[model samples]
Target chain A: MPARVIVVTSGKGGVGKTTSTANIAAALAKFGKKVVAVDADVGLRNLDVIMGLENRVVFNFIDVIEKTCKLSQALVKDKRVPGLYLLPAAQTRTKDAVNPQQMIELCEELKPDFDFILLDCPAGIEGGFKNAAAGADEALVVTTPEIPAVRDADRIIGMLESMGKSPIRLIINRLRPNMVQDGDMLAKDDILDVLSIDLIGVVPEDEGVIRATNNGEPMTMTLDSPAAHAYLNIAERLLGNDVPLMDLESYTSRGFFSWIKKLFKRRTRQY
Target chain B: MDFLRKLFGGGNDGSGAKAKDRLRIVLIHDRTDISPELLDSLREEIVSVLSKYMEIDNDKIEIDLDRDEKAVALVANIPVLRIKRGNVDYDKV
Candidate 1:
């Protein structure tokens, strides 16, 4: 069967588009599906770094597009996940290196070999955005629960709609539930109301994500933290699994009370 | 402003709420390729045109552009204060 081409995009920068793409692709691959994540952010390529495949990138997206290397040569096989692959973006080239038509053709080529082709789109609605979106069957727009991010997400959705992108889903990244509960941040409902897209996943603000980034390991590799669990759930949802959203309240740290409660319950059970 | 709101008894109209409201209005304009100023002028024109036919409550009149997944709609809620009776009444006709 042909692969489902999904584009991960956000009009604003630093909202974790690449991180989501890397983790989701890894999670899908972990489920035994043949998955390849294509980094479409040509100039500022970081997906390869996030996937820990940067040093191994002999050939890149531009090489495949420019017909200098075969698609297989450019795909860095992820050893950690059996069926996972990463097609690094060209760090030396610009977005103009590849056109929209070429991107569409690339997806067409990869469709037969991979089960999922996830495109990590660059920020803004420029040539990069157009090229990244040109080949997508569906879109995942990632945003934080902030005004600027949400506003940009709305713009991206509108643009995608105009371009006839089907079934665009929302992924709220770095969501601080405690802040939302304290009325310091925008709630999920507020974001959903504005964007009006189907919710795919909501990742909590976890310090582990930063650690994972530093280590060049995606959170989906280990489902220990709330963020990792969220990414894994998103992957499951992507595979057509009807999983309920993670209850962030329970997932949040209750501080010393939970520890004391656990101790108290253990002592009472001894009787 | 946020500090003031924090000091005072701010209800749902916190910074987040304000952002939501602002984004809603901005998105409407962005989708329709229209500006807020243009929408205001359009409201004024619509009110003037409607006032010639009926007694309209300008203060109560609401005009906005709303969008869904497929289409965009210009929704106007014009409150008719009173209907001006024309020269030819329905009963007489």
Candidate 2:
């Protein structure tokens, strides 16, 4: 069977589009499925660096499209996970380097070999976003719980609906539970009320994500991080498994108790 | 501070509610491509055209885009004071 080409996109930048793509692809590959993470950001390629395969990107997707390199040669295999690969985008070229038709054709060529193809789309609903979305059978729209991010996500959802994409799912990233409890940040229910899409997963704000990125390793590689568990659950849900949503309130209450214990310990030591 | 306010039941309507309200209005405009100014102008044009045939209570006129799950409708509630006498021939038949 051909691979399921799914584009991980957010209309706004810095909402973890590339990170989600890398982590989900890695998680899927870890499950023993063949997966390829395609960086379709064109001029601003970061999937290679995020996947920690930057040094191995000798050829890119553009090179394959232009017939400068074979598709297999352009694909950079991730030694960390079996059956995982990276198709880097050319940093020097502009988004106009490839059109929607070319992207569709590329996905066709990749379909037979891989079990899943995840496209890391660029920000904005311009050529780059359209090109990335053109070939996908499904979409994973990522958004943080903010006014601008949610508004832009709504616009993207409208566009995806017009394009007739099936089963558009939402991933709420960087959700701070304490803020939501304080009625400051938008809650998951509030976001769903406006976006009206299927919820795939919610990744809590985790400092470990920064460290994992700096090390060129995704959060899913380790079993300790909360964010890693969230990403793995998303992979499971994508595979048609009915995984329940992560209990964010448990994290909040646990944090509160830990803080109170630390404060009591400090006061006793001060005496 | 936030916890204290929440405990006092003072800040229940925080910025989250404000954000949701603002997004609701903005998205309606975005989806229909109709701004407040555009709606006002449309109401004015409708009032003018209706006033030529009937005496309408202009102050009570309301026009808005009503959105449901499937479609948006330009709903107008125009109050008429009286119909003009010479605008129509009641005995034309």
Candidate 3:
């Protein structure tokens, strides 16, 4: 079967688009599916660094497009996962280095070899975003619980719908369950109500994500963290499985003792 | 006061609710591509055309774009004081 080209995009920056792409690709590969995470940010390359394949990248997507290297040569296989690969973006090139037509052709060439091709799109609604989304069959729109992120997600969803992309799903990142319970932060239902897209995953704010990124390892490779479990569930959902959303309360519920502890901590700080 | 509210579990409507309310109003304008100025002009033109046949309550007129699940509607609430009677010329106001 031809690969499912899925673009991971968010209209606003710093909303975990690259992190989600690396982890989801790694999770899918762990499920025994051949996956490649392509960084389409061009000069602002990040997936390679996040995936811990930066030092190993000798050629990039631009190299492959310009005929400087074969597609196979440009792909950097993940040493940790058997079936996962990374196609790093060119650090010296700009967004204009490649166009949507080249992106479509690249995805076409990757279709026969991989089971999943995930594009890590650049932020904004300009040419970079268009190039990343051009050849995709599906899209994963990432956003946080904040208003600005949700608004941008709505705009991106409108664009993706006009582009004829099917199964556009939402991934709400950095949700603080405690804040939601306190009615301080937007809940999952609130975000879904605004975006109105089918949700594939909801990842809580996990410190382990930052640690894993800095260490150049995907959390899915260990399956030790709550966020990793969420990404795995997302991969299963993408494969047409009816995996239920993770019970986030299990990870966040610290009971009355922790709340009382926080109360005293707040009181002590007033001095 | 915030600490006391947290202790009593008596939270107000919350900032999340405010955010949702703000987004709804902003998105209505965004989705319809209609600015506030455009809506004002639209209301003026509509009231002028209607005033030729009826005594309209211009100050009380309201025009808005309302959105639901599948579609958006241009809803107008224009109160008329009375209807004008007589044969009206097509071209002459």
Candidate 4:
């Protein structure tokens, strides 16, 4: 079967679109599924850096678009995973360097070779966002628990719906469970209520994610990371495993291990 | 047991409230493309319609727009004035 193309986008900046893309792609690859991480942000490309593949980007997304390299040649194989590859965006270019048609054709070439093509989208409601979304078979919208992020996500959902690419799944990232309990933060259900879509994952704010990205490593590459497990769980759930959403309290305190403890406690306490 | 549940169980209800309250308002603005001024004008038109009938009291009448699932509608209530309720108030007619 052809690969499923998914554009990971958030209408607002600093809301984890790139992070989610890198982690999810890496997680999917770790699950033994073929995966390609496409940095579609063009001039501001950073997925390669986040995935620790920046130094090795010989042929880029624009290279594939301009036909300077074969689509397979453009794919930079990840040293860490067998089937994971990256099609990095050109570093010194802007959004106008490639159009939506070029993106659609590029993904079409990649479809037969991979199990998943994950596009790391640029922020905002602009041309870059439009081009990144054009070829995706599915969309995974990332949003923070904050009001502004949710509002922008709603606008993006409205725009996608207007373009007939609707029913986008939501992933509420950077959630703080303590704040949520203290009535200071937006919860996952709250974010989902406004966006009104099926939720694929809820990522709790984790310092390890920031550290991993700074270290040029995909957070999903570290199985010990709380966020690593969440990403893997989401990827597994994507492959038709009915993993339940993580409990927020456990997430904020001890990460996934604590979350598992709470799950069992809830089961035992059910009287 | 009930109190323990109260203290811990429903902790994350704040976002739920914010979403329902704020998104409903924002979505109304998005879909209808109607400004507050338009809504005000619409309310005025509803009041005028009520006035042309029996002794309609505008002070007690309230008309507004609301979203019902996926549709927008003008929801209004025109209270019959005390005088109008007394057999259509033909006193000055």
**Candidate 2 whole-model C-alpha lDDT, 0 to 1:** 0.90
Fold similarity of candidate 2's chain A to the true chain A, as a TM-score: 0.94
Q: Rank the candidates by TM-score, best first.
A: 3, 2, 1, 4
Which tens-of-lDDT digit does each residue in B4-92 have in candidate 1? 44333355344667666767776766667778899999988988777766898878888887777446888999888888777336685
The candidates' DockQ values read: 0.22, 0.32, 0.34, 0.13
lDDT of 4 by residue, B1-93 (tens): 654553454543444466556666666566666678987788787766655555677677776777765568867787776433554456867
lDDT of 4 by residue, A1-271 (tens): 9999988988999999888988899899988999999999999988998999988888897987888888878889999888899999998888999999989998999999899999999999999999999988788888887767888888888788777774478888887787776465766766676667889888888898979888988888877777777787889887889998777686456577865675565456544
Q: What docking tier does model 1 reach?
A: incorrect
Model 1: CA > 4 A from native: A254-271, B1-14, B35-93
After superposition, which runs of candidate 4 have C-alpha atoms over 4 Å from their true positions? A252-271, B1-20, B34-93
Per-residue CA lDDT of model 2 for A159-209, tens digit only, reads 988988888999999999877865778999999997889999999999989
List of chain B TM-scores, one per candidate: 0.58, 0.60, 0.60, 0.45
How large is the i-RMS for each model, in angstroms?
9.4, 5.3, 2.3, 6.4
lDDT (10s digit) by residue, model 2, range B1-93: 755544444646767788777777777767786888988888889888888889999888889888764457889899999999888677983
Please give the distance, in angstroms, between residue A155's alpha carbon in candidate 1 and its true position after superposition.
0.9
* Model 2 stretches astray by more than 4 angstroms: A254-271, B1-11, B34-93
Q: Give the Cα error of residue A93 in candidate 4, in Å.
A: 1.6
**In candidate 2 chain A, where is summed lDDT lowest over 10 consecutive residues?**
A262-271
lDDT of 3 by residue, A1-271 (tens): 9999999999999999999999999999999999999999999999999999989999998999999999999999998999999999999999999999999999999999999999999999999999999989999999999888988999999999999999899999999887776677889998888678899999989999999999999999998888999999999999999998888877765779987876675467434
